[model samples]
Target: MRPIYRNLAGLIAFLGVWEAAVRLGLINDQYVPPASVVLTRTVELLGQEDFLRDVIASMLAWAIAMLAAIGIAVPAGLLLGSLPGLRTATTAIVEFLRPIPSVALIPLAILVIGGGPESKIALAIYASVWPILYNTIYAFTEIDPLLIDTARSCGAKRGRVLASVALPHAAPFVFTGIRMSAAVALILVVSTEFIAGASTGIGRFILDATSGGGRMDLVLAGTIVAGLLGYLVNDGLERLGGRLFRWHAATTTEAV
Candidate 1:
């Protein structure tokens, strides 16, 4: 039993059980459509012209928001994390806002940003920044003090030490933060779209299918697509991080 084959077999068994339960009336199709129906509607959606447009819009919003979060968070986090006094001064404020749910800001965002694409992007960025910033701070604080002392003894300037020592050591933690940001960004993207009453994107598609009368199959199909997209994004980020930080991966593998 190969690992991949075992995974496939497990998936097939789960789907078969789900389909049987739906067919046997133990589960209601109106609320939770069978996997077969969802797959059929998913295929139909792939053929729709509007589907690509929705996907592109969602992807565009996600990319822009993520880029903005990284751009702002990394530099700002580095600056604050390097300055102990500044970090101490700002800890109270950061802690206060970090606990506030991003979804709770949607109403204020709608009022100010007017339920547009900009609002969605803004919310995504807001939700993503905390993870990136916090991880970066942790990365900086967790550096080996002995390593810094050794660098200083070897006559490395502050800039050289930071560029060669600090950044390299922190890279893994920073990438970990970005991975978390990606997941958070996806949630905010769909959530803002659904709540803002937008006319396009996967969230809107789900809303329309669910609310526009008997289209449980379509709703389930949209959900499946969303889940697949999230999975692919997370996997892609993990692969990229693994490649960029091969040393980290090697150390973890050796430890395991």
Candidate 2:
């Protein structure tokens, strides 16, 4: 079977089991609504303006974070990757800062930037930058030294060599990093919204839905929506990567 068909079939089978389990009282309906119930709620949420707005807020925050991260990481990666001296000089600082959890910084973010869009965006950018930066650096490192040397020997300037020989090879890897960061960016956005109790986003929607209690259905529904959002975002990026960089598509797909 095609992978999509297998995935669909598996999902259906899982939902069938869940529905049967709930109907048979193997699981408490009060705590865990059946799959049908949650799926209906997810569909309903798509039509509701409030939930849609929250989704949009989350997506907007993610988009801003991703754009900012890409803008910062790509150039920084190119610079650091090209300059062994600079890369070596900053290795200690980069290693020190890279391992700190962005979630761990939520408290600091809340205190410094407050529980606003800025705070969430800032946190998302911090979390999402690493993958792209590392990927870009790795991409530059992977370029064939012969290609660069050939360009230089043929009278190409440093800038010309980078722009021509290095960049094309790096483009695919940079895009792969972008795809990785895209998921991280979304996770950070939602996580910040939920933990910080931001005024908007899907995380807030889920929090609000469960605050009064006895709304497990709504909570699950919101969660389902969030999962779908993540899947769609990743899938879209994957397809785009495949189309834009056909030479690298197989590697990218396998990596993902």
- Each prediction's Cα lDDT score? 0.89, 0.90
Residue 151 alpha-carbon offset, candidate 2, angstroms: 2.1
Q: Candidate 1's error at 194, in angstroms?
A: 0.5
Alpha carbon lDDT at 10, candidate 2:
93
lDDT of 1 at 152: 89
lDDT of 2 at 137: 94
**lDDT by residue for model 1 over 209-245, one digit each (tens)?**
7789969998888888888888899989998998899
Task: Write one digit per residue (lDDT tens) for candidate 2, span 87-145.
Answer: 99999998998899888998999999998899999999998899999999998888888
Worst 10 contiguous positions by lDDT, candidate 2: 247-256
Q: Each prediction's TM-score against the native?
A: 0.94, 0.93
